[model samples]
Target: MMAATNNKEPQRIHPHKFTLWVAMGSIIMMFAGLTSAYIVKRSQSNWLEFSLPFVFWYSTATIIISSITVQLSLKAFIAREMKQYRTLIGITAFLGVLFISLQLVGFYNLESRGIPLFGVKSNSATSFLGIITGLHIVHVLAGVIAILVLFIKAYFSKIKNYSSVPLEIISTYWHFVDILWIYLFIFFNWPR
Candidate 1:
């Protein structure tokens, strides 16, 4: 008797989606740890109660807008509209840069008010906030780098047939990071 052969094809998991899930999970863990620490320490003595920097709200809005633009880019790519995709990608890249700039401005504003966003160590609370925001800022910088790489790939590469997967992954990761920041901002602003 001849050996039976199965005709079923293996389902291919998109590598980009897998990567996005991994990146999002890592981001969630990072922010989860930070927020947990924030709550635990806020309950402790000598936790300086201060108003969160207003610029954080602005930065949050900007990042949310950027997420939308990135989604738009992915949709355009899926529709095979190269021109719209390119334009949206460029817009998303610029928004990422703008978000970083806003974050920097927020740090500066906080420091000008003596709130130690960039390494002010007056107390444990300040230190914690400084470190938490700093770490998140570093993550934001990584997102910016990822977007820049995406922009370059979309512009210079000739692999136009199936190049949108990477962008889709990066976009999802970027949006996840943005939402994480909003969650953090709310947690930090919550009254004890």
Candidate 2:
């Protein structure tokens, strides 16, 4: 006897992907709360306004370029161009390091301008800048680590398939951090 088959789609999500999404949502909520606090604190009488460091602009550009490189890497992987994929992943990791270095330069620039994070002269603006950017740096570091792992796997001929879910998940997280930085940059630099 032949068995009848039901063609309904599965209602369950992959646990890993679902966990990542939940983590991302939590991150979004945390940032939203921090930014909201920033906005509320900006209305106080002791708020100090300052120009963002020029290096931040450069870092912003670097991150944007890195985002492009990551997307290119994904494309190359999909095309089974392992060499190109590895190269692009390396470039993305390099750009991530550059972004972190530029952020440090920005902090130094702020300090040189007498806007230290915890000195008597330090104000809410500088504190917010430091906190927000520092948190973002942590996220970028995580992304760089992910990219390095992918690069090492590719180098060792471990990544045989182009349809890797881990690669897609990492790409999504990278892009999220990229966009988050862009938003924070605009928010910090917006004219009062």
Q: What C-alpha RMSD separates each model from the true structure? A: 3.4, 2.8
Clashes in model 1: which pairs?
Answer: none
Cα lDDT of model 1 by residue, 1-192, tens digit: 999999999988797697768877886887788778877877878777887778878888888898998899899988888789888888887887888788788767777887774343666687777787777778777878888877787789876666666777788778877887787788778777
Candidate 2 per-residue lDDT over residues 1-192, each given as its tens digit: 989999999889767778888988998998899999999999999898888989999999999999999999989888888789889999999999999999999999999888897667788878988898899999999999988988888888654755667777888888999999999999998999
Number of backbone collisions per candidate: 0, 0
The reply for model 1, stretches above 4 Å from the true place, is 1-12, 118-121
TM-scores for every candidate against the unseen true structure: 0.86, 0.91
Error of 1 at 157 (Å): 2.2
User: Global lDDT of each model?
Assistant: 0.79, 0.89
**Model 2: per-residue Cα lDDT at residue 48:** 89
Model 1, global lDDT: 0.79
Model 2 CA lDDT for position 140: 94
